[model samples]
Each structure stands twice: as C-alpha cells, then as structure tokens.
Target: MTYSTENTLLYVEDLSVSYGDKTVIKDINFVEKDVIRTGNVTGQVIAFVGRSGRGKSTLFRALTGLVKPSSGKVLIADTTTGIDNDAKVVNEGDIGFVDQKYTLFRNKTVSQALMFALRNKEITKEEKEVKIKEYLHQWGLEKVKDQYPNELSGGQRQRTAIIEQIFCSGHYMVLDEPFSGLDVGNIQDVKDAFNLMTASHEFNTIIYSTHDIELAVELADSIYVIGYPSIEGKLADYGTIVKHIDMKEIGLAWKDFGLDHMEVVKQIKAAMLSS
Candidate 1:
C-alpha cells in the first residue's frame, strides 16, 4: 500500500492546459493531487475535487488524449498510448478513463459491450471468460451482464461502464464523477471494485474527479482541489488555496484507507507544513 522506495511510474510536470487563448489552468501539477505541484504518481489514488468549472474534466481529457493540452506532457508507462502525439512514450493499455456520464451501447448487451472492449487484447477465450466473470462478480454485474444498457438501472449502467474500464488492465485509471448516479448499494459495489482492482491487480494508480469533497476524502489517497480564478478575485482565490493547506496541516487527512495509518496522517501533515 506504500511505495516509499520505487521507480517513478507516471510523471506530469509543469502541466499548463488551456482552451485556445483562454487559460483554464496553468502550472497544474497532478503528481499526488494537491500535495505537490510536480512529482511522481505511482501507487496513488488522486481525487481531483473542485467547483463545477475548475477544469476537472478538462484535466481528465488532457490526460486521456481526448483533448490536447496547449502545453505540458503526460508521461505514461505500459501500453496506454497517446501520451505524446509527436513521440511515443507509452503503450495503449496502460491508462483507462471512465467518462463522467455513462456511455454504453444501448443496443448491445452487457457481455457484448465488454467483449467489444476486449477485441484487440489478444486474450484467450478462457482468459476472457475468467476476466469477465471476475469483473462481473467484483462489480456485482453478474445478473445484469446479459441485459442491455436501457434494461438496467442507472446504477447498474454505471457499474457496467466501470467494469468495462477496469477490465482493460491499465495501470492508471481515471473515473470522472463515478459516484454521481449510484444508489447506496451500487456505490458500495463501485468502491469494492476499486479496492479489488488495486489490491489484486497491479492497477496501481487511479485519478477520480468529483465535486463531492467528502466522498473524495473517503476514496482518495491524495486530493487535488482546483478553483478557477475569477475576473475580480484572483488574489483572494489564491489565498483560499493557502488556507486549504493551512487547514490540512492541522490534521484533516481522510481516513477511508483505514485508521491504522496514524503515522501516515502525521507524515501528510508534515508534508503540507513544509510545502
């Protein structure tokens, strides 16, 4: 659960992403979420939390190659490609991203949809079946795997979408607002899916974005807060970031990973103080 001594798995430094001339975010570092501006992201669960227009989705797009950043680079390992359009740095299966809204083939059954994702992976039929069953059980999608998207409830749809992403065997996974449309039971399922993926597989990193700060605290190992600077209150907004750090320095770390790491909390507090 800890990686105090390991190689850098993913690194993003001085990442400045913008939409045209309008700068949405600058000097944004997604290393360990808010804890650092530029560092290594490995074996880290980073939750990007902010207001509606703080560019959380924008950050996700840039990381996944859906949106090109005006500047900066995302260095990924393994097979997930498109980290750099100009030069190859990583493969195409190392990173997986879950869209904020549910996106599935309404016409295709759950099994069909998952099979579509596995088409190019070169996995054996038995291996694929095993993986599908494992994910279905892990996400509680066993009964509904034979149903279509429209036939399932909102939570079930979300689970299907998440399972599809997790089965990609990516080291880094990004889920945008993954808890938005889920009931209590499904929320627990999604949380369990995360735990199992990180524990059983070497799926080390996850970057989940949400407006729910409380949920982020519960699910994230590191938190990233992005507040947009308005026309008249840029200085004050910067001050708020400072205040956030000050508050966290007084021992406000999230405890969902378990209450056993009291020393981890102290270390996080110390790191915040030094920063």
Candidate 2:
C-alpha cells in the first residue's frame, strides 16, 4: 500500500447551532474536525463530552442535517458531491447516527431491518442476506435475528441498532450515548463491537457523546469537553489522559458518588496528558 501525505476530509469552519434565540454551540471551528488526512484518504474519530444541556447532540444533528445550524458551514469531503445544502450534502454511507432513546424500528425483524438498509444502498438481495448474516454472527446476534426490539434485552437492542447502521456501509458513526442502559459486561461488548468495526472498515470514524467521563476517556480517540450553548470545548488528543478526574467536576455522576471512581479519574487525566 502506498501512503499519501495530502489527504483531508470533513472540514468544518466556524460552525454553530442555535434553537430560536438560544445558541447551543457558538463559533465552533476546526480545520479538520473529526477528519483523517492522507495523501488521498482521511479518517478520524471525535468524541464529544459535555453536560446535559451542552450542544454536543445539537452539533451532531446540525452536521447530519437533523437540526439546522444558525451559522457556519460543515464541509464533508470525500463522500458527498456538494456541501451547499448543509442538510442534504453528505458522504454516502458516511454518517450512522444512533439516538439515545432507541431509534431502531421495533416492528421490523432484525434480518428485515438490516436488509432494508442494504437495499437502500443499492445492494442486491443476495448480497444483503450475506452481509446481514455476517453482521449478526459478528455482533453475537445470530439467535436474535427473528426477535423484535421489545423482546430483546437492553444490550441486545443497542447492538441491533448499531449493527443495522454498520451493515449499510456507514463509515462515520455518530453514537449518541451508545452506552445508554447496560451493565458492565454489555458496555464492554459495545466497546468491543466498536473496536471491531473500526478495525475492519475503511475511512471509518466515530463521534460518541456521553456524560460519563470514564466512557469518553475509554472509548474516544480524542475528547471534547463541551459547555452549554457553546459550540466549543476543551479538546484533548487521543490517549492524552490516563487518569480520571472528578465526574462531578465534569458534570457527570451528578449527586451520586457510587458512579464515581477516583482510580478511573486518575487514569483518564494521566492518559490525556501522556499522549
């Protein structure tokens, strides 16, 4: 394989999001926001972190066209043809957005849902089945293919949602609290799945948002500490901190100390600065 040194993807300039008069993210800008640049290729993972009211989700929605931004332009290169509409222009199979409150269609069977996605991408029937099987097996959902969302456990449901998006050839995934409700084991499973997806795919990136600082430090290649109504945050490069700090200080674990782990905090901060 040849390596190129001039690849650039997904450029956002002075991006901001607003709800009527209330601004979520303000003057958010990055030359290569969540982008990887090679000679002719680029991939990147940007993890967004902030309090409940912060514009983390709002920024994501604006970039993906679900929400409109008050100012700035989001330039997604390498996948789409134009960046004019802001809502319409995007890379094909680029953004796989998973909502916090479960977005998968409960009526559709797992296989049917995945097939629907594949079909939308112009994949043939035979190819769709093959891909669905592959995803089901890899995600440990082979047994649940016929099960509905209501029948599965919370972890299984989340995995199903993630798998549906991935099978459609989505390279960039915007996971809104991907670990919404799950046990420690399930959380690990989600992480493993995410790792596997990134490892096997090309031009893949993830923008995961969560209030859990530990989750951010563990899952994100880079971390963004966002404040409310502001389109900016403190960004720490990948693995920059190894120690975890006070979740309360970061607005996580609110009033509960049980969710607080000092050792994890120490590791996160250490990892952040080390890298």
Candidate 3:
C-alpha cells in the first residue's frame, strides 16, 4: 500500500548531529514510507545500516530524544491526522531506547533489574510482582528471571533487556546495535523474538542500528543505509540516510525471503558504499 501522512508514526526532518565543529551526520532525509509488516502485525520498523563508527548509534540516540539534534527536529505523530511537525519535538517518554551494552547493574538478576525499572512507578511490592511476572511470562523469560546478566546467554540477555525497557518505558523502542556481539545462533534467536513482539504489536515502532546488512533487509520495514558522505566540504561528516529502501514494497515474503533477499542485500551494500 502507498504510504500516507497518517501512517507516518515518527518523522525525522532535516536532522543533523555533531560533537562540536565536526559534524557526524547531516542531511538525514526520508520520504513518506509505505506500510511495513512483521509476521501477522503491521507497523513501522526502521533500520539504520552502515559501517562501524558511521554515527548510527548517535542517530539512534537522537531518535529516542535522549540526544538533541544539532539542528532540525524529529517529529512524531501526536494526533490522528496531520503530523503537525512544523516545530514539534518528541520527549524521552514518547520513545524507548535499549543500549548496545544492554545496561545492567553488576550482579543484578533479570528480576532485580526489572524491579529497578519500576522503582519510580510508585506501585507496591506485590503489585510490582504481578506486573513483572505477567511480562516475564509474556516474553518467555520465566526460565531466566532469576539469573544475572552475566549468567544468561547473549540472546537471553538481549531479550531480558528489551523486556525491561518495555516494562519501564512506553510503546516505541529504539535499539542501538542490538545484534553486534551475538553469535550466529543467538542472532537468529534475537531476530525471532523481535519478530514475535513486533507481530504482536507490543512495539508501535522499532528503530535499530546495525552493520548486519542481510539481517536488516530481512527484518526491517524500512532500511536506511547510513554512511559518511565524501562530498567536497562534507568529508569527515557522520553517517546519514543515503538509501531508504521500504522492504514492504519489495513484494517478497516477510523474514522468509530467500534468493530475492540476497539481491536486496547486495543493493543495500551498494548504497552503503555510495553513501
């Protein structure tokens, strides 16, 4: 289906980020995107892909409203109709961010970490138990609830982190290089879990940054190939969206793409190179 304004869940308009005088990314632009699907669910899933140190993580931070953009705005849908994004800016609560390291206190069990997230909820101990247990069961995390972060597998730890963020924050989630350190087996497990949650509408939108092109093509509804531009004065600038491929419009099966998926992967890599 053609993408309209109403489906524009999160909008990034003329956004750029910088450390000081050195610009990390600039001219990050995206067109109106079409409907994206995962399993039985239809929502927005955007992927930022590029080489390491290409400012993908920084962009993720900006998207979550944790870091202010050097200029421009990240507009979100605050109404049923128009974007109303002229000067609109989203705050932290409108988005959820899970870091690449999967923030955890030393020696903290998954249950303990979750409880820490709820410390500000003002709910009683019993009430917190009920909520945490409900989500633990929902996320298939009951088996590892008692284990500390160091004791869990990579996939288990990642899943626990995601569950903790959703338990702590609201709907939208942004993951910074979530698949970076996982083994091949664990990578597939994390991918499967994400598909399951997204299919269930547990996350209204999921934005993640990765260097894994093949996986991004398979999982993301929209893939933004970020890279450092080599333009005259733009040298040394950070990454920006050079290619915006809406996977939903590609007409291949979701996550089940075979040979066709590789073709798209090659194209995304080509864009990465050109960016």
Candidate 4:
C-alpha cells in the first residue's frame, strides 16, 4: 500500500497548555500531511491513547482552539487561501470538536439543525437544502430527518452531531472520546460515519482519543501516546506525547485486524501502563 503525501494538513510545535499554576501538557509536536494514494481517496485517522489523567482532552481543546496554549502553536492548511503550504494559526471555528455527549439542538429537527450548520456558508437556501439532504442520505439519517435530538437513538444523534460539524466546519474534525459509552452496534455506526467522512474528501482528517488500544490500532493510521515523562530518573507531572506509531509504516494501516494488530495493541498498553 504505497502512498504519497502532498501539503501539510496539520502541524503542531512545542505546544503546551496550562491552567493557572498547573501545566497540563507540554512540548507536544506532530505533523500530518495530506495523503495521496493512487486510485483511492485517503484521509487521515489519527488516534491518541493514554491512561486517564493524561492530557489528551487538553490537547484536543488546544487543537480545536477552545483553549489557548501557554506556549507554541498549531497550524493547519489555510483552506481559505489554497493548498500550497499556506498555513495559518488555528483559531476557534477553524476545526470542529465533537465530545462524548454528542450535544445537539434539542428544539431543532435533524434537517433544521443541519440547515443551521450551513447558515454561514455562501450557498443559497436551495443549495443548502440539497447539501443537507445528501448528507442525511449518505449518513443513513434520511429516515430520521424530521426527528429531534430527543427522539433519535444514541447512534443517530451521534451521526447527526458529526454531520453538523462537517457542514459547520470543513475537513478538520477532532473527536474527544467518541466511542465512549457506545454499545457494539452504536460503535459500528460511529465507525461507519468515520468511513463516510474520509471517503467523501481526501483532506478530511479525524483526530480522536480513546482508551481502547485495539480500536485505536484498527481505525487510526497514526497513533500517539500521551503520558507523563521521566526526567533525571523521576517522572514529571506534565503530560506530553511520549510515543507515536505510524501504522502505515508498519504495514498495519488499512488492513484487517490480526495478530500483528494485537501485538501493537499490547505495545501501546505497555506504554500507557509504564507512563
């Protein structure tokens, strides 16, 4: 599975976040490029795995610009300009974030919520309606288009939240513990939503965090482990990226899960435990 990369889709350098006197995460860095594969549309699915109390949630907040970092910066491709390495500092609204709760408008029906997501777009009302319809159909939410958030199932609500982000934002999405609390069937539904998003565009990137190491290995092409680092033979209090694994480089990406994946899962679990 040979693939080439184009422009940098996401870039982070020396990023650190602190709250008051406590430094949560520090010295975080990573880069993800727009993957180009022959005869296939490739999108990035990056996962972060670590023990609880690690800074995964804080990192996600900074990535989505919900919280400001105390140091360093995050940059994503300037889609407003062009795809020619024109980078811009990430700000609020630059990326969409979907949390575990899958929050939605209680009063708005699925169709209405989707339409509201497109309110800032330059397209006309008819065009927006068409786009919403397409997404609802594609995500298998067409039958529930008229349903409100309270009326939908957990999976349906999650899918609607995901689609809302897609329409409101663009290619970049950050999901914080998306698989949390989901049953097996609902988990598959969310997985299907991930596939649909990636298949729809080449630059569509999904960055997520999970405790399930096997699922991280199975779904993500790239995985990062965040944990407290040791310095001078003593463990530090701050969390940072301790390890990164490229599934593509190891011939595990986009392949069926097997013994190889299980081994990687074990490795990740060990990393989490030690850190």
Candidate 5:
C-alpha cells in the first residue's frame, strides 16, 4: 500500500515529565503526519511498548494534557482554527484519555452519558440525540442504550467509554494499557472499536501503550519502544524512546499477522529486555 503524509497530525519535541525531583521521561520526540491514501481514509494507530516502570503512563498523561511536561511541548492539528497550517499546544480536554479501568458515570445510562459528552457541541438537542443514537447503533451498544454502567458487560462498558471520548474530544485519543486484563473476546471488541474510530475519520489517531508485543505489532502502524537509554555501557535512570519501528516501512502494517509480524514482535521483545 502506498501513502503520502500531509499536514502534521501530532508532534512531540523534547518532552520530559518530572515529579518534584524525579524525572520520569526525558528527551522524548516524535511526529505523526496525516496519512493520505488514494480512495481510502487512513488513520494512525501508534503503540508504545516497554517494561513496567518505564514511564509509558507518564508519557500518555502528558500527551492528553493530564500532566504538564517539565520541558518541551505536545502539538496537534488545530482543527478549531480552520487553518491548515495552524497547530495548538495540547491542553486538558483537547485529547480524550481512556484508562484501563474504562471508567464511566455511574449514574448516567449509556444514552444519557453520550448526551453529556455532547454538552459543549454547538448542535441542537435533537441533533445530539440523533448522533448518540447513531453511535450507539454503530458501536453495537443500541441494546444497552438505556442501561447504566453497572448493568453492562465489560465489553459494553469499554465501548461506551471510548464513544464518550470520541464525542467529548476530537480526533486525538490516548488509551493507556487498553488491552490489559482483557479476555480474548473482549480484546477483539476493543480492536473493533479501534477500527470503528479510524474508519470514521481520516485524522483519528489512537496512541496507546501495551506490554503485549504481538498485539502491539498487529494493531499499530507505528511502534515506539520506551526504555532506559544506554550510556557508557550502562542504563540510564530516566526512561526514553529507545527504538521506533515503522510497520508501514517494514511492510507489516495493515496486514494479517504472520511470520513477519512475529519477527517484529521478537525485535520488540529484545529491545524491551535490554533496556
């Protein structure tokens, strides 16, 4: 598959996060551009994989503007400005974040929760209702539209959480350990949700972290391995990006999982173990 990049969709430069005296992530930098493919809408799925305590969560928090970076900036396409070259520093609520727990409003039904997510939209109530209904149907949550979070299954709740984010934020979304603690069936459900997002919008970018190397290789078009950097033959204390694998460049992205993908998985595992 051949594709070309247009305007920048996301840019992170010299991003570092610190908690008081401790620096968690340092000198992290990456950029993702709008992937243009003829006769197809191609969104980006970027994955971060590393050993535990490698600051993946901290990186995600900064990306979503939950936590401010001590140095550098995160920038995204400025859709609000309507200028193609305009970009904005990411702010809180600019990007939706869905943690592993799939948190939701306990008191709100699936339909009501979706309505709340659209509160800031300029659309009328009737329009919002129509949109919510459309999303519920499309996400396979129509049957549970009136049910509260407590009454829904894990997959249903996860879908609701994701849809809420899509309605609240714009194209950028950060999911921390989304596939963790999920069964095979539930994992498939999440993967389907990812497909739904990417298919719906060309600039819809999903940034996620996971320990599952094979799943990351299978789902992400670009993969970043975050780990301790080596200096003078010794590992540094601060975590940073050690290796970046572009599945698209390697002819592994958007393809069925096979020996090639397994090979990439092994490469990722080796990077993780050494760092």
Candidate 6:
C-alpha cells in the first residue's frame, strides 16, 4: 500500500479469456502502483495499445463483464476500504461502455436516443428537454437532433453515441476504439468530452483501446501494450506490461520537452514491434 499514494481503481490479475478451446487472451496482470497525487490519479485514463485482432476488444468485453474470464481475477478497488474486491461484485450500473460496433434504434431519432439515455432520471419533462438540448449543442448534434441514426453522417452518429454513454455512465467510461470512424471535428469533441468528464469527476476510469501509439501517448496517463495471442508454431503471449511511461513525468516544467515526447513514442513503437 505504501508503494503508491494513489488509490488503485482497477486491478486485473492473471486474467485470461477463452472460447471453448481457443484461448483469446491470457495472464493479463495490471495494477496502478505509482504514488501519483490525488488530482493526477482520480481521472486517470489508460489506453490498451496494440494492433487489431490482438484481443483488445475481447479484453475490453471481459473487463466490462460482457464475457467471463476463463481464468484469473478481475478486481475493482473499493475507495473506502482500499481493498481489491472481486469482479462478481461489479454490476451493469458500475461501468458505462461505448462499444466499437454501432447500434441504434432504426426507427428513433438522435433526440429520442438522448432522451432514452436519461429515462431513469427522476427529473421533470422540462428538465429532460433542457438537458437534451444542452447535450446536443455541446456535442455538435443540434442540427441532427431530429435525424434518425441512419440519416446522420458517421461523425454525427459517433457524437451521439459518445454523448449518450457519457450521460449514462456512472464510475467507469470504457471506450473501445473511440477514435475510429471519427472525423477531425468529432474526434476533437470526444477528446474534449474525456477531458471534461475527468476534470469534473464524472468518471473515475476513462480507459480506451487504440492501435495508434501516438494518440495513446498524447491521451492516456498509462499504456498497456497488448501482445498478439499465439497460434501454430508461435510462442504463447498475452497482455504484458511493455512499459509504463507517465506523461506527467516525461516532460519538465522548466524546459521544452516536445522532442523528448517524440522520442518516447518511437521507443514505444519499437518495443511494440519487437514484442
């Protein structure tokens, strides 16, 4: 416990996933052990950086409880007790996930989807409308509010999905390849939303998956380099801690360290390619 002042928000110990005979992921041991300051750790975001088809999506599914892990432990650190509790204790309401696949009610409009996300709130009808309107404006979906998911462009649809998930999510906001399928404008919106949510204490764990190492380094406080699972004539490998580069510690306040960052990115890519 003395290792880090930051409270452990999540712990994945010896985690593995399988579909009958084929193992998708194995032995993912991850923990946040740094003694980060409270302000720096509360909204900490982590990225699982790896190539596609490397079980990033599968691991995300297991983390969100969509699929059960074949072996090992998945724990959520309790804030009060500082205990890493079992995964069984996690409920659907505990985490909000923005999936890689897109799904929408073909019959409903973007406005309807936003309202649906807030259906459980005890607020009045007037409050719901106001909240929906605010979100539409904030997410650049005001013009497409009445448009069905199919009618909207790729960027609009992605914005709608992200805004809905953010509104519905409680503690953790786990996004699978959020940067994918987004335009420059929409990507900026999603990035701003992540920063806002973390700063406002809307979500504790803002984790995502991406193959772009540069984007991962620019965003996440920590990175988990997921290794490609083994096949025929290949050595078995799972998720390993390739490197833990703290962005806050990467650059100094007195000097310009932009070039230093570029070097780190290159080093990370080298490690990934070698892995």
Per residue, candidate 6 scores C-alpha lDDT tens digits across 63-97 of: 77788888876666544453543223344555678
Over 4 Å off, model 3: 1-5, 31-40, 79-88, 122-127, 230-236, 253-255
lDDT of residue 226 for candidate 1: 64
- Candidate 3 TM-score over all chains jointly: 0.85
TM-score of candidate 1 on Cα atoms, chains taken together: 0.75
lDDT for each candidate structure: 0.62, 0.62, 0.75, 0.92, 0.92, 0.71
lDDT, candidate 2, 54-91, per-residue tens? 56677778666676567777766454444432322454
lDDT of 3 by residue, 1-275 (tens): 33322345576788998887878878887643325432345556778888877888888888888888999888765543334433246787667788987667768898998888888787899999999998788767799899888788888888888877776665478898888889998887777667766666622677888888877887887788888777774545577777777776676535576898899999988877766
Quote model 5's TM-score: 0.98
After best superposition, candidate 2 residue 21: deviation in angstroms? 1.8
RMSD of 5: 1.0
Sorting all predicted structures by lDDT, with the top scorer first, yields 5, 4, 3, 6, 1, 2
Looking at model 5, report the run of 10 residues with the lowest lDDT sum.
Answer: 79-88
Q: What C-alpha RMSD separates each model from the true structure? A: 6.9, 8.9, 3.5, 1.0, 1.0, 4.3
For model 4, residues 51-120, the per-residue Cα lDDT tens digits are 8988999999999999999999999999777649999999998898997666899999999999999999
After superposition of all CA atoms, the RMSD between model 2 and the true structure is 8.9
Clashing pairs in 5: none
Off by over 4 Å in 5: none
Per-residue accuracy of model 1 over 1-275 as CA lDDT, tens digit each: 21333334566656667676777666665433223212433245666666566577877777777776677777665434434222234334456888887589979999889887787788798888888887777677889888998899877887777767766746678889988867888788777767765564343777787755556666665565666444453332220111122223334333344453444444434433432
**Cα lDDT of model 5 by residue, 212-239, tens digit:** 9988999999999999999999999999
